[model samples]
Target: MRALLTTGTPPTWTVTEIAPPAVAPDQVLVEVTTAGLNRADLLMREGAYVPSSADWNVGPDRVGFEMAGRVRAVGDRVTGIAPGQYVMAQTGGACAELVAVDHRLLLPVPDPQDLVAAAGLPSALLTEYDALTGAARFRPGDRVLITGGAGGVGHIGVQLARALGARTVIATTRSQDKAGLLRELGATRVIDTASEDIATALGPDAFDVCLDHLGGPVLAGLLGAAAPRARIVQIGRLAGTHAHLDLETLAARRIQLIGTTFRGRDTDELHALNARVREALPGLLRTHDVRPVVDSVLDLSEAERAGQLLDRPGLTGKVILRIVA
Candidate 1:
């Protein structure tokens, strides 16, 4: 099997031959068709985000969080899914020809014909869904705010909020060119962070819920503007991890601040979370309401190029690595 392997600090990755993973009774073996490139992959490569599971350290295939593939084999206990079925899953060691994923975690590709785009859906969708519904406890008719709205998770977050019946959805982006795209996706208002400040643009006490991806100083300012008793779910820290919170403001407004990640969860918890997403995803996809954005698709062997594209500033949507076909 050929996989993208990472080497050294500020790591560089390349396609190399590696042993295929073995299947456990609760797992299904998949012939990977495509894998999604995430910021976590880039961070992991650069030795910033370490894998939370030991399986990721088992071999040269150091990092793969999400993939779309065809089920090639199923363990004895695995049911409902069999060989030749198209599916997507969240699992480590997915940047390879074959990967073994827990049967419970496998998701039916909403659009079976376009597995390439489907590959990019798992991480972004699962992460955002959990943040909005699980952590933030978002309700229909709530006013929502999504930071870094042009990025992978951010774009999808916009659409999901709207599909969930959010009364108002506001998103922030550094590029004005993306304002139209963000609005088309579901955002009622798009803020160009380059010129206007987010807190001022949205106005204080404007949003009922905020799905924050870009943390740091910006988050602190945004917190001050959240509606009373509003919920803010912190999904990613692309801007910077550290943020100073105003305890007084939070207490005065009764705002809830939550931090969430899939990496920290156990397998059972992940499976449960994915199950919730799986239930909601098909409906949204069927209606063409929430679509996963794919910036580009590169061949699996061009792993280094994919990494480079992801690293480039102002890149929007998910970068996919085509493993087969």
Candidate 2:
């Protein structure tokens, strides 16, 4: 099996042979076809991770988070999964030819023909799904706001909010060139952060809920934009974590600023959350209403190029690395 290794602290792609993962009775062995590149992958390359993840050394077996593949085999305890089913999943490591993951996390691809795009869906899907549908307590007909709308999770967040029946969906991006695409995707309004101030452009108390990924200065803007009692789910800190917020406004409006991540969750908690996503996904996917934005597809041999693509400023959508294909 060939897998990509991370040269610690300023990582570079280095592929080498590695043993396939051992399968547990409750897991499935997948023949990885494509894997998605995430910001987390870049952070890992820089030797950054949760302190507990020290054992997750920079190596071939520790580089990927999400992948799409065909089921090569299922463990004895895994029910309803059979060989040859096209699926996608987020596992501890997935940049290799084969990966073993819990059967419950496997998502059956709605369109097997689009498996390459499916490789990028799991992480963003789970992140925004949980943030909007769970943490933000999204309601149909509510006015929604999605910050950083051109990125992988942000673009999909825009579509999902619309799919869930939001009366208005506002998306933000640093690039004006992407505003048209964001509107095409589902945004009722697209804010070009490059030229407009998010707070002033959006006006006050207009949005009922917000799924915010860029949590620096944007956080302050989202606070003013949210309606009374609005829920703002902070899911990412791409724009730096520090922010200067107005405590008076938050208290007066009864706005609930919530934070979320799967980082500290246990297996049972993740499985439960994923189950909810799994239930709603098939219907949404069938409609072709919400899908991953794939920026580029490169062979696994071009992992370094994929890394460069991932870092391109204002890059929209996931960079996929084809594994078996």
Candidate 3:
């Protein structure tokens, strides 16, 4: 088996031979076709976001969060899935030729033929769904704003909000070039943070909900821009953690500030989130109104290059790694 391993250093990834993962009774052994590169992978490699288990070797810490593949074998207890079934799953060992994933976390792949593009869908889409529906409780006709709209999760967040019937979708991106792309992804207005201030693009108290992928000063600005009784979901801190908030303003407007992260959830919680996402998968993909935005596809052996590309500023979407035959 070949996998992209992290060498416990910043901005580094290496492709090397490794043993295939052994399947548990509730797991399915998959022949991975593609893997999605995520920001978490970069952080974990840099030793910034360590999982609960601290003893695991960094080398085998295979770096990927999502994958699309064909099931090669299913454990005895695994039901509803069989060998040769194509699927997408949220799994840790995805930057490899083979991975064993819990059947509960797997979703059947859509009719589309490109498994590589499909690989980037699960994590980003599910995170956006959870942020919009689960955390923010967004309703139809709501005016929504999303920070980092050109990035992987932000791009999907913008589209999902529109699909869920948001009357107006506003997005913020540092790249002016991506403004048009964001509109194509369902944003009614795209704000180029490099040239325009979000507060200026959108008047004060204009949005019913704001999804912040970049915390710190940007997040504080988002909080200040919320409409009365607005709901703000904080999901990522790409800028930096620690942001000052105006408690008086938040209280006066009856605002709701909620913070969530999907990666650290317990098994049962993750199972529930996965199930909800699976139920919504058909409609999400079938409409073709909103799908994962794939920026580029690289061979499995080019994982380092993929990581570097993801790290570069002004990326408009996900970078996928093709892993299989």
Candidate 4:
């Protein structure tokens, strides 16, 4: 078995042979077909992101966070799911050819034969579902705003906001090249932050709910733009962690600002979150109304090139790592 490793202080990933993972009674073994490269994978390389569990601290003490594949073996306690079933899961060490995953984290692949697309769905689906519906507590007819709207999780956030019946869905991006794609995915408006003023573009008291992944100045602008009693959920800080909040505006609006991260969650909590996201995914996929926007697909061995691609600006979707069988 070969797993990707990030070795050194600055970090560089390379495939290295390793012993296969052993399954526990509550776990299943998956023969990985494809793995989605999340921003977290890029952050982990720089010693910036940490996995939820130490079990992932393998070679150079890092691992892949999400994957889609076929079940190769099942634990005695696992039922209803069988070997050969195509599945996607949120688990550590997913960059490897095989991974031992808890059954509760499993979601059936929407298209068993299309592993490349399935590979890009898990992380975005789980993260945004929890952020929008669970943390943000989205409601129909509400005006929703999403920062980094063309990103891996942001694009999904756009679709979910519309599917749930938002009156208006506003997204922020660095450029307008992705505006049409975002609109097709359900975004009612796309704000090019590089050229447009977000607060001016959307106006005062416009959004009922806001999901922000870019912090810093972007977050400050959102704080001032939020409607009264709006719910603002922070899922990422890609723009920089520190931000000066508009305290006066926040107080005037009675806004609820929340910060969410899987890093602080326990395994059981994540398993439950994954289960909930899994339940809602099939309906979206079946209708062909929501699907992952794949930016590029690379062979498993091209880990370095994949990382470089993710670092580029104006990326529109997920980068998938396909393991050739």
lDDT of 4 at 195: 96
RMSD of each: 1.6, 2.2, 2.3, 1.6
Q: Compute each candidate's TM-score over C-alphas.
A: 0.96, 0.95, 0.94, 0.96
Candidate 4, run of 10 with poorest lDDT:
53-62
Model 4: per-residue Cα lDDT over 145-179, one tens digit each: 99999999999899888887899999989888988
Pick the winner on lDDT between candidates 1 and 3: 1
Check candidate 1 and list the clashing pairs: none
Q: Candidate 1, 180: how far from true, in Å?
A: 0.9
Error of 4 at 117 (Å): 1.1
Candidate 3 ranges beyond 4 A from true positions = 8-11, 52-60
Q: Residue by residue across 84-192, what tens digits does model 3's lDDT show?
A: 9999977776788888887888888774388977898888887889889899998989999999998988999998888888999999998888988899989998888
Total clashing pairs in model 4: 0
Better candidate by TM-score, 3 or 4: 4
Where's the lowest-lDDT run of ten residues in candidate 2?
A: 51-60
Q: Score candidate 2 by lDDT.
A: 0.84
In terms of TM-score, which candidate is stronger, 2 or 4?
A: 4
